[model samples]
Target: MFVPFLIMLREGLEAALIVSLIASYLKRTQRGRWIGVMWIGVLLAAALCLGLGIFINETTGEFPQKEQELFEGIVAVIAVVILTWMVFLDAQSVAQRQSTTGAGSR
Candidate 1:
């Protein structure tokens, strides 16, 4: 229960950060008018994720114990993969930024 809540909270905040940054940048640059499509896409993604979660929960509950275990394992592996990728990408981005800034000061 807590795990799901925390995971969802973290993931939601991560996504929200990206959207907020884009929105803020747009406003700062006076291109805020184009934010409508970005907001719409974000809303659509949220809706799709919610719908998919509900469908997965309902469908998983309909399975037998063994099948449920298998499903849980698969979902866990997928989550691990996603988390790993996100962390790797974040580190790579940060490294690139540092390198670029270092080179620029030369």
Candidate 2:
């Protein structure tokens, strides 16, 4: 219960931040109308993903032992891939800074 709640909270905040960034960018650039469309699309996507998550959780709850293990393993692998990709992407700014500083010192 708490785990799902915390996960949902974090995911929600992250999404809210994304939308905020998009909206802010659009506003600053005088393209607020386009951002409205983008936000609607994002909301639709988030709704779909949430529905899919709920469906997956419900369906997996009915799985038997070995099959459940397989499903769990698959989910874990996908999560690991996504997590690693995110970490790499997040560190990309640091890499840019490192390169910039390294060149400046020469």
Report the number of the highest-lDDT candidate.
Answer: 1
TM-score of 2: 0.51
- Expressed as tens digits, the lDDT of each residue in 1-106 for candidate 2 is 9987986786677667556655655674467889769968997998999898799888865678899789878976776676566556545644665686674421
Q: What local distance difference test score does each model get?
A: 0.73, 0.69
Worst 10 residues of 1 by lDDT: 97-106
| TM-score attained by model 1 | 0.52
Model 1 regions more than 4 Å off:
1-42, 53-61, 103-106
Q: Write the per-residue lDDT of candidate 1 for residues 68-96, one digit (tens) a residue.
A: 78987897787668666766655565567
After superposition, candidate 2 runs with Cα above 4 Å error: 62-106
On TM-score, the candidate that comes out on top is 1
